[model samples]
Target: MATAAATIPKDLSRLEAQAAGVLSPEALAYILAGAGDAGTTRANAAAFRRWKIKPRKGRRPRKVDLSTTILGTRMPAPVLFAPVGVQTLAHPEGDLATARAAAELGLTYLHSTQAAYKMEDVAAANGDGSRWYQLYWPTDDELTKSFLRRAKAAGYTHLVITLDTTLLGWRPRDLDRGYSPFLENKGIANYTSDPVFQRKLVAPANVAPLPAGIIFSGVFQNPGLSWDQLPLIRSSWDGPILLKGIQSPLDAKLAVEHKIDGIIVSNHGGRQVDGAIASLDALRPIVKAVGNELPVLFDSGIRTGRDVFKALALGADAVLVGRPYLYGLALGGQAGTHTVMQRLVDELETEVRKAGRRSHRSLSRSSLIRTP
Candidate 1:
């Protein structure tokens, strides 16, 4: 018997088909599942559908400039590849392929602290392209410092500190599978590379399994972290720092008080809290609270070009897409990922012209109409 070929569609729908063909049911569920009843996940998409673009006439441009500079770095489009962990489970190349695709497209790629590939490997693959590092704030302060030092040394210009997931949320799929990829040694690149983390381990030569207590200790030990610790991270890192997982307007105000470079308005893709407001719903107020003092980026529930447009119109300077690209990776590795990204850029460009806008600069909240 022979394995079936993974189907590749010319568009985003291909990603769905490819995922179906290539991914096992467990893998698919792990990637796609949401928290609790999954109402928030559905709400994220529904929010995008609720906002319709208000097109203008006789204002089309011969060329549309999709490029924008974010935190002193130029990106071909406002879209960035958001950091997601444990790619090896989806594809053989893992983060390396995703980095290559982002580099080729001249877009920013955010590499997760929990990436299957180490920071240096992804940075090397990036090769002068724009790449940012996402940190999970390890239980050990020394381990955290070590990861930041390595990221800075690797030429990653931006550091995104993910404030969510200090504790993992209720994910039914993972629960059903008895699956936590982290426990399987999947998304432990930064940890495995950390001198501090390694110090806690028995000698590598001995090949003894890490004690269950030790494993749980590292996993659940970050609850003492507080907002005051932002200064500690700033003191250790020497680049632009972004605070991810911010949702409230008040928190947005506080992030500016902390003097972070950017704020990612996110709800951990509704994975952390089930009834939390959709990221799209939360973006405008945060942008308003920051009041142009800092860039407000957004993530969660972005699926298509129109969704990107909706985000920008609502107040996001740029958008981070997580699962969509992962779907592409699961389906076709680098090519699949590249196609999905390009499709978004292409759609945005088309929609821009159709709406009589030449650049992202002209897009405003006025360009969107809310559903009745």
Candidate 2:
């Protein structure tokens, strides 16, 4: 009889292929497109190939230990689900289904600020599983405070402040499709539930109908946010806080000075600044700058178990996968997400054994070699 684990899909690329089949061309392109020339996206993948792993000979590998602890929480693997909003476009169940899959897999799932379901609903789906909330930092101070309070109350253990997206990127795919999910009220969960957002509307004297599309436009941008305001966020939350878009070493040093718990080396998956350094290329210097003072997590261009291993070897304590699992969700909703997670875990286990390492601690800088 086939074991339960054996029945799950073993190839992540297969999930990607399935996603390609299922998702509309516009949806697929919207999620996959990078800003401007898209050179950074291609560069991210190429950087991984430049580094080659040097395997040892005459070593016997018996068991692999993939379990790791991040931000004081134990996870079965070093992979975390990166936040992707407006999942409803791919599936009816949306973020709720993705949350359930993450909970079952013992991995951390970061819920996006622009999620389809409300934070509380995603939390309910998580049901005691480790979760982190990503915040967009609204332009209004009161509104930002309200969101922070609600996220904490909703059981999010970590607060990921996304510093990358002050405005939407010039995504040609989305622009060509004339697709703006926000304008259609697709990924506006936090906005709809916000108290300050609610206040913008003039309620009828005797319970009259609300005005048309007035609430969304009022709470969209935060032009005045500067580094000075970060302290207010720190004051509001009593949990681990991470600054998510640090690509430069100097910024990494500044984040450490702020006493933030962690920093994610990201380029918003190449969706923010065109021609920004590929995140993988930027990881080494940032890790060196922090110099063991803070935990550095990496994202962008992480698609396979080999990529995960390479990231760990390159000083990333953990890695966040964005489009790969989104592909999974698009292909089969909850089951698809589970399949993608399992394939990644399996590949990591296999690679760990092949590398002749017993645990993550043993696989360090010495375990990797750069391709000439």
TM-score for all predictions? 0.94, 0.92
TM-score result, candidate 2: 0.92
- The CA root-mean-square deviation of candidate 1, after full C-alpha superposition on the true structure, stands at 3.0
* Candidate 2: pairs in clash: 139-222
lDDT of each: 0.82, 0.81
On residues 332-368, what C-alpha lDDT tens digit does candidate 1 reach at each position? 7888788788888888888888888889768999999
lDDT of each residue in 126-181, candidate 2, tens digit only: 99888999998877778888988999999999999888877767888788887777
| Superposed Cα deviation of residue 25, candidate 2 (Å) | 3.0
